[model samples]
Target: MKAIQISQFGSNDVLTYTELVKPQLNPGEVLVKNRAAGVNPIDWKTCSGGGAAPFIGDLPFIPGWEFAGTIEAVADDVEEFKQGDEVFGFIRFPERAGCFAEYIAAPADQISLRPDGLSAEAAAGLGLAGLTAWQALFDKGNLQASQQVVILAGAGGVGHLAVQLAKWMGARVVATASTENHEFLKELGADLVVDYKNESILDHVNNVDLVIDGVGGEVGIDALNCVKPGGTLVTLPSVTKDEVIAAGKAMKVKVEPIRAEPNCDQLDRLAGLYADRKLVLQIADTIPLEDIGKAFDASRTGKVKGKLILTL
Candidate 1:
């Protein structure tokens, strides 16, 4: 099998496409033949040696976190999936499950059946960003219907999905993006779109029920002011304890930072929403497996509007 692996953490130049052995299935795991893989900021961060996990892999580590593929084989203990089943899921993400390769072995419960009417590209793109948005808006933030919610960086990977998910839950959605993405954000159900470069997000938006911060910086900390009293603010990257405490005192709202976890059950529920036509997928581009290096460069540019996928 051919895979893009990192022998050592450095730059994008550290990643190379080379031949490697496919992962062998373990008990309670299923071997999936990759069809499509999602590229994310975390992938690059890991490749560059700037993540929370220890870099202890023997040189040449496979570095993909999410994918959509079909089952090639299954462990005897796996009862829910069988050979030849089409599935998609976030595979042991952040820690790496080698989704960049042609095949991966992951726990059966971690993979869900792909929704009908969705392509492998869309399904592959849905895992990390989709789950991050879902968990932040619905799980951690406890957002409710008929409330106003502001999403920072609303045109990026998680922001685009958060905007749509908040709308699907009946919330009034306001998204922050550049002028070029106003129409795109609006289509994703952003009732109001602010150009982050030209306008102050808080100038026209205020008293929000929840704020999902996809871009964590000084601006993200300041975004806490937009939340209503007793409302919640969920930060995607990381919010310092001091930031959370200050937000609580100044705004009278709860401020929380969240890291997404892989939940197969949640993936199943999300799949059901897709099956019912409630959720939407926005893909920026799809590259073949052999062209993963180019895809990585595009994702690093931070100008891509939606998810970037690598088709196997």
Candidate 2:
């Protein structure tokens, strides 16, 4: 099997396209021949010895969290899927799932079947971002119909999806992006789009029921002023979560930090939504697995409108 491996964590320079033995399945596991893998900010951060690094115990690690592929083999205890089944998953997050390779040994409990209408590219990019948006809006924020919600970094991987989902839930959506992305976000169902660069979100919108903070730090802290009393602000960046929470406390608003988890049920629901055109996953670019470094560089910019994918 060919994979991108890091003998030690540091930078994109540490990633090497190399050959290794294929992974063997454990109980209730399936071997997937990977078709595509999503490149997220966490992947680059983990490789740079920051995000999710502590959970990755040793050297010679493979870094990727989500994948779409076809089943090549299955363990005896796994009866839910068979060979040649198209599947996708966001699995074993904050731990090594080895998704940046041509093959992955995936637990059956963490994956879902990819519907015929969802392409491998869209299915691969949907898992982590989709689950993050779903969990943030419904689980953590408890958003309801007719409520108002604000999504920071609205054109981002998770933000873009969150905008649509919040709208689908019947919430009035307000999103923030640069001037260039305003129309794009409006098309995604945002009733309003604020140019965060030259304008103030606090000025245009207020009394929000939920704030999906994708860009943390000062931006997140400032948005606290917009949430109505008793409303929630779900902060996505772990690095700045504590400070944001402190700010939320000062303003008497609720703040929650989120780490997207694997739920096969949620994955299945998202797949169904994609098949129905109620949900869509955007791919900024797709690079070959051998060019993993290029994908990492693009993700590092933090300016990508959508997800980056690595084709296997």
lDDT values, one for every candidate: 0.82, 0.92
Go through the candidates in order and give the C-alpha RMSD of each one to the true structure.
Answer: 2.2, 1.1
TM-score of each: 0.93, 0.98
- Tens-digit lDDT string for candidate 1 (46-84): 777765336435556788878898999999989999999
Best by lDDT: 2
Which residue pairs overlap in candidate 2's backbone? none
Q: For residue 7, what is the lDDT in candidate 1?
A: 82
State the lDDT of candidate 2 residue by residue for 1-312, as single tens digits. Answer: 899999887887899899988887888899999999988898899889888888888878889999999999999999999999999999883234489988999989999999999999888899999999999999999999999999999999999999999999999999999988888888889999999989999999888999999999999999999999889999999889999999998889999999999999999899988889998887889999999989888888878998898998
Model 1 TM-score on a 0 to 1 scale: 0.93
- Give the clashing residue pairs of candidate 1, or none: none
Candidate 1, RMSD to the unseen true structure? 2.2
Off by over 4 Å in 1: 55-59, 93-96, 238-253
